[model samples]
Target: MTSSAVDPVRLAGERRRIFLALFSALAIALHALEFLLPSPVPWFRLGFANIFALLALFLYDGRAAWSVNMVRIVVASLFLGTFFSPRFFLSLSGGILATLAMTTSRKLGCEKIGPVGVSVLGACGHSVGQLLCAWWLIVRHDGVWFLLPPLLLIALVTGIINGFVADALLQRLRRHPPFEDIADGAHSDV
Candidate 1:
């Protein structure tokens, strides 16, 4: 009953919000950087923003991750002048769905599989989201299905890279006890 007795629910909510804000800002910055850099491949990106999504999975839960992702996409798009485009919506859909899949899979006791496994799952979900959008909104052609193989391949590669980055960041975050203490205080499900 004492204040020292941490309220797990309150802590969890606070941690979730903090993580969400941090990830959203990170996502926006990454998105802006990608635009400023202007890569050769139009849609291809390092997916630096996804690091936060993966972190959310490990630190919080699926719902928290998804929420953070959605906010990031919307805010990033608005800032990058893509907020109203079909591409923006498509990418958002794909990214959110993918993050959700990865977080959910991890939560289901697949932790042993690690970030690589989660990334692969997320990549698949990303591809699915894109394909759906292409079919329903843009091309409206069955040939779009043919694009899946290559897209999936790209997703796999990028996902792995993103996963590794996330893993590294998580490791670094873990080493900092002050951050961990803040995180625990915010998300203690005790």
Candidate 2:
């Protein structure tokens, strides 16, 4: 073999990090892009970035999903100049709760629910988390929760959208042998 010939075995071993990095970057880009889109509600987002969190959850596990969420929040906040601000806290809380919801739903209903179901739950969780945090941090009033109805409606809509997207991508990825191996934890030494 040539001096620089690549080794398939070694590449397989590094797929975890490579996949993590890929998902994180895609999420971060989506997050930053979403910032520029106008929202019907103030501080409300379409949550395009969360699709990758679902991807990470399905492809690996909760830890990978959490990592993607955290990286997307911190890095995207830095890029958008919202780091260490109230907005940052909102994103952080939402991301954490979303990941938790995705993983829990996946674990409890793996045989019953697919990626779409988990993604919807994650989106709902994210909305709830952000709403509660916003109330606690900014509104500081009991009446702030009145927004829950509309917010949840929006969450459901967006969640379904994101869920479908994630499902389609997951279906395609699952058919690929390398990704199947990665998802199955068949790759060693990562």
Candidate 3:
């Protein structure tokens, strides 16, 4: 194929891969950074890394979001020496559910929901996922239920913060031709 004749289909796929990889690294970095900060609530993280997954989901799709999330969890866990541990599983479950919630909300709400709504839902999902896992694996007691109220409230606050960040980034990134070019067929099967 001529240089100008380069297949858009292949090009789009390549661009997506590149973005996914970049998102994963960014997520990992943020995850590590959050780990260093002292938690206001015990065992609670600000979840700064999820912005990239949200970005990937909006710019691409759920699969891309999942890829970024999974990579972030696995790589960050390994880096933090938590790989193959309960903490890793907790992180894994939370990331999985968060991405799912975001993707589902986006699909169901369509034009009605913006980044904030999607992100809030995702954050709530992540908290619920981790809470359930803790109840099942660690706490195994009814008393663990008390954590829900606080966790959900935290999730709401954190989600709104993350959502606003994602919203600002999305607005700016969408205006970018290179990003927009690859994202042109974002809704299409690539």
Global lDDT of each candidate:
0.74, 0.82, 0.86
Per-residue error (Å), model 1, residue 83: 1.4
Better of 1 and 2 by TM-score: 2
Residue-level lDDT tens digits of model 2 in 1-190: 2223778667654776798899999999999988878876786888989999888887777778888999999999999999999999998888888888988888778658777788788888988888889988988898878888887888888899998998888889888766855544221222
Write model 3 residue lDDT over 135-164, tens digit each, in one string. Answer: 888889878878988999999999999999
Pick the winner on lDDT between candidates 2 and 3. Answer: 3
Predicted model with the maximum lDDT = 3
Specify the poorest-scoring 10-residue window by lDDT in model 3. 181-190
**Which number leads on TM-score?**
3
Model 3 stretches with alpha carbons more than 4 Å out: 1-3, 182-186
lDDT of 1 by residue, 1-190 (tens): 2245878667656666876788879877987787689676555666677778877766666676777678878888888888979879788778867886787678674536577778778877888887888789988989989878877888889889888888788778867642454442133233
TM-score of each: 0.83, 0.88, 0.93
For model 3 the TM-score comes to 0.93
